[model samples]
Target: MMADHENAGYRRLFDGDGLTFGTGFPLTDNRTSRPPVERELELAAHAESVGFDALWARDVPLYWPRFGDAGQTFDTWPWLSQVAARTDEVALGTASVVLPLRHPLHVAKSAATVDRLSDGRLVLGIATGDRDPEFDAFGVDREERGARFRESVDLLRTVWREDFPQVEGRWGDLDGELDLVPEPTTESLPLLPTGHARQELEWIAEHGDGWLFYHLPESTLESYLDDWREAAGEKPYAMAVRSDLADDPEAGPEHVHQGFRAGTAWFREYFRRLEELGVDHVLVSPAGESPEADLQRFAADVIDRL
Candidate 1:
């Protein structure tokens, strides 16, 4: 069972003794175009029924065709709000919201509202954002993303925790006048800085409740975990893995984009190794013709075994 956290999402994910599993959006197809969103709720609920721990959505502000992925093709707040309404037990989150692309006030309000809607089941993953074309389109200075991301994090925490407080930043100034309403169910939302967000690992360790990263090799991950333990000491670490399961359960591993294409038996051992290395959570993106079945099989094969 999961332990207690001020935020239900955090507790469900990090307040545990071993590694856990979650899945990303567009769970059905691995395409760059629009996804089968109509089926997402059904699939999401099914995932929860089958014992998936969390469900994540990506924040792709625009569908920059030059870049190959369109993400979930829905706004994160509304999409996650509905996901929250559909599934009661699974935690809901953004794979990582592009902090620099959005204003902090808007991001804070939307996140808090989702947390309330989900009964405190929102764990926000934030990032500085890539894609120069997107930055140009949004009229955001691409170079300032790192700095803006820092400001956004600080501002989000401040506004969520305080009422009508004085705050100033490059985004704008919030004098002690009005307040951002419907504060989060918790004092503050759980923020997981994704992909470094262009900050020092130490700073990420110091400020973020956890860290969200892409899939890395075991050797590299071990080195990273060693550094993390030295700097942050037990702060939960999460990563995303793109996977494909083979028909034969005995097949060995093959290299894929962010993760490996392996048989269930080998996959289970891989996850076990991740747990032994102190990974707290993993966001798995299923890549197969039958994603829903893959979801169930993976839960049975790997998650239950863990």
Candidate 2:
């Protein structure tokens, strides 16, 4: 069972100095249209060998045609379990799991099982979910997901803490008072909220152990950090970026999503800038083909430099 480290405080899991680097799973190959899950694992193992801190996967149920890219292209739980068994030291994280779409008991059980198997090396990132098609297909109301996300979080926590816990919330009520067996190794799971998710910034600051932000320009990163710190008091913060690395060392910057398309040299410099701005960890998604090769090269060259 999880311990009682229930005090609300920001826990420093990754510092910018050591610098954790992670790549999304089932890495896409825009050039050849190949998804090399095995190649991705080989590269992830290489990342662990080189001292990259974590590996992340996304829970993308339905591929929305409008949403340019399909993330990871793997089921979240099985992928994470496979990665955990393959690697020994690197931490495992979900870029995020859409909380409102899943049952809280399932979330608690699956996450705890992975945590135990990983020997307490799981970092859970939760979100209210953004895809309209997924909500529609699941018969879940996108409009009410924010409220459901909050309730789901509460239920998961309650189940993790008390054996056969009874939960009453907007999502539903559990009356069995049945315990969720095999609790996580940590007293409380390390859950970082992705964006505000309909919750006020103050509530996010007060409740979230860490906050996850999407795209923010370099100029505004510091100011945003300041606002987040003000609301968060002392909690840590994390961010994700869609990056594509160029083979040409002299390649100029190209626009991706939250990140720039640059050579390894420029990527290294960008991470340094983030560290200077007090960003703790930056989860990078490779945007083009050769994600595995690019990530391997990144771990060997750019990641170590930071």
Candidate 3:
């Protein structure tokens, strides 16, 4: 269950001990080109109305031709702000923001702005970064990214939580001169670190409010959850999956990249298993031929049943 002290974003997705569900942006089948922005907003509102606890957007700063998929084709900050304006409830999240590529100060300011605009409904997911070409393109030393990642997280926390806080690190030096304007709805917005971020599990647990990782099988998930409990007891753990729902509700499972092609019956059992394994939240990409219909079906057939 969500603790009383956690902010709106944290509580909305994890307000209880059972599993909660959320979906990502781009709300359409066309990944090669831009999606219809208006339609995306409609689907986002629809998602909230149908009982999804949160809505996520990805941070793909540069569209690498080889990478082949542009995430929402919009920058994270403005896109989230637009989404925030359209929806009244439902927590807003970045599937993750690449901390190493962007300046921590800008990240802190933008996040706080969105958090305030959305009425304390932002859950910021930070990552060390993944794409090698992006690292080179940004002129950031890939080897030093881990250190930068650590530095950025430390810096962001201080700036958000303390007024005119003093800090010095590889990123830069701050001497309690000026504060970042427009503080978050809470003292600080929750930061959920994505994947390992080239740090020890212990370090992640100590610094992050929660953990966001890719999908895993039930056994692996249970193992990870055990480690999580030892490192950070009761701190929420979330995972993501890319799903393609089958037409038959009773159809069985077939493995795909980091997810599955399954039917409603299989999804229900799988989610129930995740709940048993202590997974606090699940972020899904329901990529059926008709995405809007898929979302509705998943909510009605799977989420409602759960």
Candidate 4:
């Protein structure tokens, strides 16, 4: 059985860490060409073997060609459930699920199922969603997504905590009330908001367990951290970086999205700087490289170094 979020075990898993490390899936180039799902899982297990702390999956319901990045080729719910079942210790997380596109009932059920299967190792990241095609396909409005996201989150929480909780929101209303049976292993699942999503810092700090950010420079990171701290009070912060490590030790820093293309030595220094800046966790994406080998190399060369 899973423990509650307030449980000591849960705290140790998420916050009481020696700096957690994890990999984001997609296993493909921005062009959507790369290894298969089996290869990706193999690499994910290898990441666990090499002492990584977590494995994160992304939801890409619709691949917008212009968006450049088609996150993890598979659907998210099943993928996360499978990954959770396969891995023993590594925490499983969704880089984010587009809450506005799916019903809160579905979100609560799916997340609870994963958390139960993973023994409370699930970290749920929620987002308002940006892809217009996905919204259109689901017959939802893109402009109203932010409102929907807040409503869905509120409803999901109610379903988890209260028995037969009623919900009313812009999307719709649940009058009879519904409870998520076989509640999450943890009393409450950790929810990290991806980007601002039209929410205020105060709301994020008061409600979110953590914050997830994209690529930002070191200078920007400092200010962002300050803001996060100001709002978070005591909650943790996480950031993702895209890296392509090379064999050359002296490779100069090449600009990537939120990270850089550098050798292990530079990578070590960069992570150390992030740690110094009070980042609680850092997840990396193997930008256009062999997912398994590159992630393993990074774990051994960079993660282990810290």
How many Å off is the CA of 43 in candidate 2? 2.2
lDDT of 3 by residue, 1-306 (tens): 433226788888877767899888887756667888998999898888887889999898888878887788889999999999999879999989999999999999999999889988899888988788999989999999889999998888889889998898877888989889988878777999999999999999999999999988778888999999999997899999877799988999999988998999999998888888889889987745787788888998888998
Clashes of each: 0, 4, 0, 2
Of 2 and 3, which scores higher on TM-score?
Answer: 3
**Candidate 3, clashing residue pairs?**
none
TM-score of 4: 0.91
Candidate with the larger lDDT of 3 and 4: 3
Worst 10 residues of 3 by lDDT: 1-10
Each candidate's TM vs. the true structure? 0.96, 0.89, 0.96, 0.91
Write model 2 residue lDDT over 192-297, tens digit each, in one string: 8888888988877766768878868988889989999888765677888766778886577898757788888888888888878878877776535655466667
Better of 1 and 2 by TM-score: 1
Writing each residue's lDDT as its tens digit, candidate 1 over 99-159 gives 9999899999999999999999999999989878889988999889989999999999899
CA lDDT scores, all candidates in order: 0.88, 0.74, 0.87, 0.76
> In model 4, what lDDT does residue 269 have?
86
Clashing pairs in 1: none
The sequence of per-residue lDDT tens digits that candidate 4 reaches over residues 57-172 is 88778778888767876788889877876778788888889898888788888888888877778887788888778888999978887778787778877778777766677656
lDDT of 2: 0.74
